[model samples]
Target: MRLLFHVQHFLGVGHHRRAEALTRALVAAGHTVTVASGGAPVPGEDWGGARVVHLPPARVEAADFRTLRHLDGTPVDDTWREDRKQKLLALFGDVAPDILLLEGFPFARRQLQFELLPLLEAAKAQPRPPLVATSLRDIIVFNKPPKRHEEVLDLVNRFIDLVLIHGDPALVPLERSFATADRIPAAKKAYTGFVAPVPPSTPNRIASVVVSVGGGAVGKALLWTALHSRPFTRFADQPWLLVGGAMMSEAAIAALRDAAPEGMSVERFRPDFRAVLAGADLSISMAGYNTALDILQTGVRSVLIPFAEGGETEQALRAQLFAEAGRAVTVDQAGLTPDLLGASVNRAADLPPVTLDLALDGARRTVEILTAREAAR
Candidate 1:
């Protein structure tokens, strides 16, 4: 089966990375996969054998997430949107895939309706329209107005054939974030569990505390607080590794590196982040989907400061859920100070690692689900 996967990540790389993981899984399962990325390319990322299609990349200009800009930091205009829409349509016509997977639309990425709405219409117009599915993470942003939910439900019912909720229903249900989840037909919904890389066998546990931001786009506050709070923590003298995400500017990384005290070190990114988590005494990071999965896989004692800028509640909700499960400690961004963060770090260090029993085989399960759907078709 040929699959065309569309993903757009404006603030962080987590969404695109998860989509790429699934694309690789599909390719491994004997399906030809093409990934259409609508965001700026993540540096040093390899998509293996999957064909990559680069759309006119755009990113959020600020925490508000209302303004978008091209990779060159220029504001996106009407002409650019039209061009991107046409290119996306052309790609759809060229691929003619067996399955059309939208990473997030209707439910989220409402900003891209200029292109996605037409893309959905074009796919349905096909004589035998490919199975259209919406691939979403565990939680969604719930701050939208009631009418937004209605619009999403209407779109899902009209165009989408399946809704792949990438999480365990037993752990966190879609309805927890999306109020209109029940409106979508049961036959169209499937919880495929969380997607994450398998843990490495031998982890390099060189650091006592591991701090990271998802893409480092909006992580300055967290990183600054963590850096300043180290002296107040119990493990003040221990090695603290701070990872500035790929999206972080070189100037920011250099500044952080210069500010590092005796035992603290800073770097741009770490490919073996999960492995480092496995060997660390405590994990400190924002509560994004992929990072949450990594922390769960390692079962490391953790302190999660969910990124809640721009009225985004998904990460905060995820942090709350994990905290309620006794899997990690949560500190609200509003209350995050050096002293508070340092104290939380000490408290988290005392807690034992709790092994979560949720499914981590989403990549394989996704292929199985798609293959079965294709066979039935």
Candidate 2:
């Protein structure tokens, strides 16, 4: 089966990374996959045997996530939207895929409706319309208004054939964030568990503390706090590896590095971040979906300071859930300080590794689900 997957990540690379994992899994399962990415490319992403289509990229200008701009910082105007829509339609016509998978839409990434609506229209107009599914992570941002939920429900019911909730329902259900999830037919809804990398063997475990920010776009506060808090912790003399995500500016990275006291080191990104986490004494970072998955798979003691800007509650909720389960410690963004962060680090470091019962075979399960759906069709 030929599959066309669309993903757009504005703030961080987590969304694209998960999509890439699913793409690779689908390809491994003997399906030809084409990924259409609308966000700016990360430095060293591996799509793995799947065809890639780079749409005119755009990124969030601020924590508000309201304004989107090109890599050059120019605002995305109507002309750019039109071009992207045309390109997407052209790609859809060319691929004529057996399955059309949208990473997040109606549920999230409503900003791309300009192109996605048109793409959906084109897909439906096909004589034998391909199965259209929305791929989503466990928790969604819960700040959307009631009207927004209604809009999403209407769109899903009208166009989407399936909603693959890529998370363990036992851990966190779709309705927690999406209030109207029950409105979607049960036949169209399926859980594929949480998509995460299989834990690699820890052959060369680095003993330093690991701190990371997903994509490095909005992690300056957390990174800076962690750097300063390192000196205040019991492991003051131990090495602290601070990863400033790929999107972090070099100037910001240099500033953080200069601010670091004796035992701390800083870098832009780490390709083997999960391995680094697996070997570390403790993990410290924002509680994004991918980062949380890495922490869970490694079962590393962790201190999570979820990014709460722009009224985003997804990460905060995830951190709270993990904390309640004793998997990690949480430091609310509002009360984050060097002393508090240091205390949390010490507390998390002293805890034993947590063994979670949630499913980690989501990528493979996703492929199986899509393949079965295709076969039935």
Worst 10 residues of 2 by lDDT: 199-208
Q: Model 1, 157-221: lDDT tens per residue?
A: 89998899999988899999998799889999988888888777777888999999988887887
- Per-residue error for 36 in candidate 2, Å, reads 1.4
Look at candidate 1 and tell me the lDDT of residue 368.
88
On a 0 to 100 scale, what is the lDDT of residue 267 in model 1?
89
The CA lDDT of each predicted structure is 0.89, 0.87
lDDT of 2 at 148: 85
Q: Report the poorest 10 consecutive residues by lDDT, candidate 1.
A: 60-69
Candidate topping lDDT: 1
Q: lDDT, candidate 1, residue 265? A: 88
Q: In terms of TM-score, how similar is model 2 to the real structure?
A: 0.96
Summarize candidate 2's per-residue lDDT along 86-125 as a digit string, tens digits. 9999999999998999977878887788999999999999
The C-alpha TM-scores of every prediction are: 0.98, 0.96
Q: What is the lDDT of residue 70 in candidate 1?
A: 83
